[model samples]
Target: MSAAPVIVIGSGLAGLMTALTLAPMPVVLVTAGRLGQAGSSPLAQGGVAAAIGVDDDTSLHLADTLAAGDGLCDAASAREIVGRGRDAIMALESHGVRFDRKPDGSYALGLEAAHSRHRIVHVDGDATGAGIVKALVAKVRETASITILEDCRALRLIKRDDRVVGVCLEGKGPVAARAVVLATGGAGGLYEATTTPLGNLGQGAALAGRVGARLADMEFVQFHPTALAVSAPRLPLISEAVRGEGAILINDRGERFMADQPGQELAPRDVVARAIAAEIDAGRKVYLDARAALGEGFVRRFPGIFALCQEHGIDPARMPIPVRPATHYHMGGIAADCDGRTNVPGLWAVGEAACTGLHGANRLASNSLLEAAVMGLNAGRAIASEMTAATVRLEPVSLPQMSDPAPVRAIVSRGLGILRHETGLRAAICALLPKAGHDDAAAVALAMAVAAFARCESRGSHARTDYPHKNASGTRKLFTMDEAFAFARELAASQPLSRTA
Candidate 1:
């Protein structure tokens, strides 16, 4: 008989690209929701960054990525991934992704934060993610070797003899597989004010950690500086592309507070987010003024954003849009290599779920998509090359209860916001330790809290009030679930509050 099919979790850009790249190889694609309706991929507004411009090159892109990483990025991984930009774009285009172009038939590139050149390749202005996913979804449906299972959530990974062999799906029994690839998105959904899909509550990290996978850089959660400041369950993002189009950030007093700051509106996301957060903390409401810059062209350039504003009874062309920092991305995840191979045998991770070290402590704008596509494709190829025909009967294992993030969301959001401190991190750790065993979200949150507390200095997206400066030497943390829980337990025991309460 043929070997069991490879099981891929999640249906975002990473998962989709992986399955697509593994064509003619039997694969099972799983997702918690409808194929194209789930995850943070479709909600992405910024385009993929590529060094295909006349004045651009891989070295230049790598330099920008490293600069944004704040001395924490793995230089080797950054260079390799940035160098694959043109290839990744071509691969996506071959899979039916048609990027926006100018009348001259050249790619229409847009500028964003931190990049020295206009390297963001978009589609229909702000709908780049949606467009790419739509085309890839259509392609996946036509592929003969891929079997898609929608609305199937992965609860935990099944490991045998120190190797992950399969995954237990929620509401369904174990699905035996030769290998498992996790493409689940990041932990932004753990935040109260976030732009990530509500269902993306760090399940990827939880699943890997439970199965003994090493996770890295868990403290660096990138907050977008300009989410629409409105009452909503999930905040709407005001993409950095708007600022690239010449929008300026102003306060209630109509002061351009970022005017004197280096790079101003175009600084790295962490810098921009902190600036906006500082303004808000000072009791001044912040707004993104696009009137003079885009004016009537606002709707034409960012139709999706324009409509979202209109729905909230605001117009970008005429008035300044209220904005605030919101959790947008997670730079930390399972410590996977360039080919998405985790330390665990037979298991791989890609996209936002895997820490390939390309983004470092913070991600360069638009580079997430580039990394996702490149790594996803690379993972698929690597997995295909390592395919084995050995068939083994899987034993039945008891399935655990489904993971719920509801209880942990408030705890995490309070402590791990744009700004963090020792007190808040410890409190979060204490509250989450007990729940880590049975609750996946709590497990992930507990690990993150520990990482945040251990890092004594502020760097990139992780800012600590007590430790307000960067350390001379920055370190990337790598820990398993056991290590995280042990650290939390030790820390909690030493604290006065834990002893009393």
Candidate 2:
């Protein structure tokens, strides 16, 4: 270490866990808003997936994860992470998290889509994320070794001799660090309708890619099947647990649309989302009906969702709740190892911002929180053991302009929605390439568009209208900003603009 404090950005679950695990070591935790008030961690409705039930084991959990990943997941990585599922749950509890329990004092595990057993450890029913963050925030605030910087945004990375040394903030200029960790969440905000905090615009991937870090699986974006269909800056998510509880998807004509699907409403998210999108595209409105299933028990099972539905003038116990597919998660990000080590020596990433090949093409339900906690703990230990002392002097670094995702949202949403094609992707790349150099959002969007174009087959969440079938063998794609930009330019020249519709 350079004797400077380790700088952790984003203040979400991964960042907080990383800071806490580095206890007794000096750490500076920075966030764009008040701690626990920003990022997607607090908005997660589902609980953490762990194999702690009587009949469940790590092997079964790994099988479900691999199945959802759609043939692209790294089997070794998935097995290792899933094997540590119980340890991650215990680690969170030690930080003051209170998971819900049954009347017998055992853990109350809930079931979600694609799981073989009931293994979701929740807190306060559907408000699991809020409950977890509340306890962790209180614990983090009281810790003596961690320093919290509120309302600070990271603009770029400061590199020296091919190693990342610090981060340049919006107004605080450059802050030197022994090592830097990026946990800035996912790129769902790049879409018009998303369930993430609007500020999460793939900032981690953009910052890492600008400094030559390899980005992986940029084409796979998961769309949640049941975001409450209403006008808002961020859509409210109706948890998959709702469907797990027997709520069926129905059209306005009262026909159960997913009845004939492989798993019906409980299929993998890509299957359900595509089904709903097809219904809406054909001039029919889709809804989730819990009236015949939950009835009076709806509020007790999912109080948070029930309250949100009430706010929108719909009662789940009486009438079906209108819903549509919305961008919920990104399985692609800065490529890293299980310990969060990136291509660059002193840079690390965890949570949704790091693509460790654990999620592959699609993520299993309730697995995001598990990955975040496990990776954060792994990264902290790795950094403490490997970081070395270096004689370094602070240098003045020029901060880039503050990023605006507004200009890139329409292009990303148009070309990178639930269904994609080559023409829309090429058009998106053509428009985004000009702005990518100066705009962080454009840079991230361009990289995703390039990857989507390169992938000529439909697999998992990446459904291509042009190629409607999966290839015999699926391989993960990785890119750097320079490589993506070069490909975009070549593609723009290879075809006429008139070919894009």
Alpha-carbon RMSD of each model = 1.3, 1.4
How far is 197's C-alpha from truth in model 1 (Å)? 0.4
Candidate 1, residues 49-165: lDDT per residue as tens digits? 999999998899999999999999999999889999999999999999999999999999999999999999998999999999999999999999999999999987888888887
Could you say which candidate leads in lDDT?
Answer: 2
Alpha-carbon runs more than 4 Å astray in model 1: 496-501
Candidate 2 lDDT by residue in tens digits, 248-325: 999999899889888889999999999999999999999999998899999998999999999999999999999999
TM-score of each: 0.98, 0.98
Residue 225, model 1, lDDT: 94
What TM-score does prediction 2 earn? 0.98
What residue runs in model 2 are displaced by over 4 Å at the alpha carbon? Answer: 496-501
Q: Global lDDT for candidate 2? A: 0.92
